[model samples]
Target: MDRDAVRLTVMKHDEPWAGAATTTGRNGSVPHQVGAPGALAESLFLVPTRHLVALRDVLRSGEDPEGVAVELGAAAATEGIGWSELLRDVEDVCRSVSGSLPPYEVVRAMSIAWTETAIHDAYETSCEDPLTGLASAAHLRSRLDDAYRLAERSGVSASETAAFVVVEIAAGSGPDVGLLRSLSMLVLADAMRTCFDGDETIARVGEHRAVALVRRSDAIRGYRALRDLLERAVDLPPLRVWVEGLPATSDAATRLLGELGRGASATELG
Candidate 1:
């Protein structure tokens, strides 16, 4: 296709192009080029606005055509947007730009990119707590299983110990206290992240309770650090904290979770 006609079509559709100008076609028409003269022109396709923007950013960042296509696919999947047409457009663009890169390599990259995005989306939805924005109970269970497997493989100790700490806030009868309780939950969550180096699995399993799983070696220290941090927050309501240590096994973790749930409604801290 004529370069000028292709450029005009892309411009009309508001697709992104490289910022360089190549040769003007016949009759004094300036043809905007991407990467090379006929690179983006060969595609002559339109993608979703967000995907287009992401593609432009990736291109401008100077990624190779295959890498750019991978990022484009990933960006589309992350935004829950379709990318079949977008991938075709990108493959066309890449083929036009580079003759050396194999078609199979491009397809593989795109597949890997979208698959990773799907896995990430699943992890976020299934293993993340919506309320406190921490790892969910399911995630904690999975981590415990991994810890046990690791311990067994290393043969260092069959009875690897871990701690499960639960933090509960008292709900006042008035709306003002309810607001205070909500704010305190956020503050306490922040404190847990800071005290634990943001590595522990903390989850809000109930309206008034949050739980954290930590290595037994650091559990008492983490608990002390959290207590000090919470003490500084004078405006927060009374808190109740329960700490328990157990072998890092599936049954032990389940029992600890059950105990934490049952005692989450205990008397408030003085």
Candidate 2:
């Protein structure tokens, strides 16, 4: 059987055909209908039977497929496509190439895109926000549970053990707000580390807001000290500082963060 004997028919997104990858020949490029909905998707595409669309790039006939692979990987991740499924797709592509697993370089590039997007998906509903290096609201609730549990064992209220020291930075409505907010938070986080010691968890619960779990025993005293440090380290105008006592339960504590997070500038320490 001649491996090159297959008759490949490349179809367009605008074509009347329903976007199928039906194969009829013994050897040739396998054509899958491009599903992108755009008038700009008029470019012609012919894919190898192994489903390796990069064959064009590999054969120096069309645009780069590296970006395509990345987009596929990212799309797979967001769509909740599993690894096994992705491997099957890879296998189809490989059949046109090595007829085995995908080439290491291609796999690496795709895997990187997949992993990055997958991690973002996890972070969206999980413990931490990668950009801010702070605990998500969900993470804070669990930490609160631990604090309350320990407090219970020690025969004290949660408030006796934990409190939130919040820092809210004020930025103008200018276009630079995102950059300004991030930089200000970094400065605030650094000051938080210096003043709060290592035991507390710091979290960003709202835009331009961060809260560090502080020892209520020292929160009042520490607030004044941290306020002094923030003033010195940050030249950005008007930083607000306040201490919020933990409520009776972790549930309430999570809600408290929302309330404290509102408004710009300092309020009297409560």
Candidate 3:
């Protein structure tokens, strides 16, 4: 099939696949294991959009497919999908392009890429992500604690006054997808900074994830502006934005935060 046809075929399934991916199980996302019959594409659709684009490119150009494979690996890591599952997706995608699939070596490339990025993220050893200059996860937690305390003193429910603005930005697809994600985060940080225009503790909680702690009163206006600005953004996949109310207690809020960064959908959070 031609490139346009390939992309269209993949995109045709987006609506139903999105519904399935967002459906939750014991965890907050698509299950790590193979699910029910005909579930391969359901899981594949949850992988980053760029990964699918790269795979399409691999079949079209037949150049440095390993690079595409490794990117798929990184995307899987970010999406919390497993290696075996990704391989299955690759095989499934093969059936799309005249039974031509990238060899198993592509899967090996993915494993290596995932491991290297994981190790780098593991030993980050900073209060801010060096890549995006957003507050560290630890710092975000501390800020949450402080917010809860201030709410306690103000005699209003924290849920009434404060909420989280979570934005899931889909970056442009490319061979250097890691860089694409980082670059998009930079754009997102600027947009959040401009829209919130306050002491919002904006954080890059996970790959493709960002959150800002903002006053609920301001959130309605801020979210409107944020969506406008991001919608005008060039070269990005669709952005997902929502203002989640603070959970009942600080501990519960923290637990929710743990899931937020890992690409949990709004349905799961609710």
Cα lDDT tens digits, model 3, 11-83, are 0110224433344542334432244343334443456544755675676676777888888888767666666
Candidate 3 clashing pairs, residues 3+ apart or interchain: none
Tens digits of lDDT, candidate 2, 138-207: 6876787889889989998777777777777875678988888887777777777788777888877767
- Highest lDDT against the true fold, candidate: 3
Kindly indicate the candidate among 1 and 3 with the higher lDDT.
3
Q: After superposition, how far is residue 243 of candidate 2 from its true place, in Å?
A: 0.5
Error of 1 at 233 (Å): 0.4
Ten residues in sequence with the least summed lDDT for candidate 3 = 5-14
What's each prediction's TM-score?
0.47, 0.54, 0.54
Poorly placed runs, candidate 3 (over 4 Å): 1-125, 171-174
Error of 3 at 170 (Å): 3.2
Q: Residues 149-192, candidate 1, lDDT per residue (tens digit)?
A: 76778874324455566667876677577677678878888888
Candidate 1 vs candidate 2, lDDT winner: 2
Give the candidate order by descending TM-score.
2, 3, 1
Residue 140 in model 2: shift from native, Å? 2.1
Q: Clashing residue pairs in candidate 2, if any?
A: 6-27, 29-48, 29-49, 30-48, 30-49, 50-92, 50-96
Error of 2 at 15 (Å): 27
